[model samples]
Target: MNALYHCISKYHSIPSGAWDALCKTLTKVEIPRNSFLVKEGMVCNNLYFLEKGCLRGYYNLDGKEVTYWFGFEDNFVTSFYSFISRKPSVENIQALEDSALWSISFEALNQLFDAHKDLERLVRIINEQYYIRLEERFMAMQFKTARERYEQLIENSPHILHRISLGQTASYLGISQETLSRIRSQG
Candidate 1:
């Protein structure tokens, strides 16, 4: 939980008492590699703080998995729409490695928001960051060529290549596995 505390403090400093209260609500969970934290058509009832390892959010489109985002250690992970709207999610969140996570249920989180206003501000800031990243990915897919996208991924997240399969990376870049192989060969 130290990692979670440190990450949260970077965004907003919660009073010690509020922090304790928040800690009490957290449930530690372990997800094995290739296991799902949330699956399509399920309501995401908990928001997770990844303590260790990796996870990816993807959509199953006509039987193909299209990964859009990856979450690393010290990051928050959730199906934002389903978590907030109380609706079933259209995407899935799967652990890419054996992972340790701390989760807080939506009900407990709301109670904390009502009690600790600062926590609410912290969540708002986190949401804004997520939106900014989403916009950047959207723009890149709209304007960048496959090679350019692969280069940008190498520049921004080279470690991802070591952590995930090349096929998954290719999916995230919206390119064919063969195209990614060709790009790698050119290097």
Candidate 2:
């Protein structure tokens, strides 16, 4: 509710009327710990607002789960390529804890975008922000030292150490649990 409104307002100046209409279309869902919000090979039809709890995006590779992104409270969580392309998701978005989420269907969002220019602009901004963050993560993995990547992750998500498991955090940083342990000890 308020979190959704705040997220939208952070990017654009939307009218109360638009928020009222948007609220009418949004559904609140509770996901349990260790459950998948958007499963791999399933089409992601809705975009999620992470009102509470945490979600990690991961995919299987070489029989192992590789975590790539973690969405925390107030962040948007969705398999964007799947959501936009209307294809099955390659990654799984999993709840790390009991979570409260607000979801809007693809059709409902399109309708809102058609009716509200502000909301449309907000969506564009959201896409651009996601792209920029993704680029940073990719460059870090390809070029930055492991320690630098770990430091950047800590700077980007200050509460991540408290909220996330070390193994998952290590995977996101493209490092091993032993490496993470060494890094933690060095700190």
lDDT of all predictions: 0.95, 0.92
Query: Model 1, stretches more than 4 Å misplaced?
Result: none
Query: In candidate 2, which residue ranges exceed 4 Å CA deviation?
Result: none
lDDT of 1 by residue, 1-187 (tens): 8999899988888899899999999999999999999999999999999999999999988889999999999889999999999999999999999999999999999999999998889899988988999999999999999999999999999999999998999999999899999999999
**Each candidate's TM vs. the true structure?**
0.97, 0.97
Query: Residue 164 deviation, candidate 2, in Å?
Result: 0.9
lDDT of 2 by residue, 1-187 (tens): 8878877788887888888888899999999999999999999999999999999999999999999999988998899999999999999999999999999999999999999878888889988999999998899999999999989878878788999999998998899999999988999
- The C-alpha local distance difference test score for the whole of candidate 2 amounts to 0.92
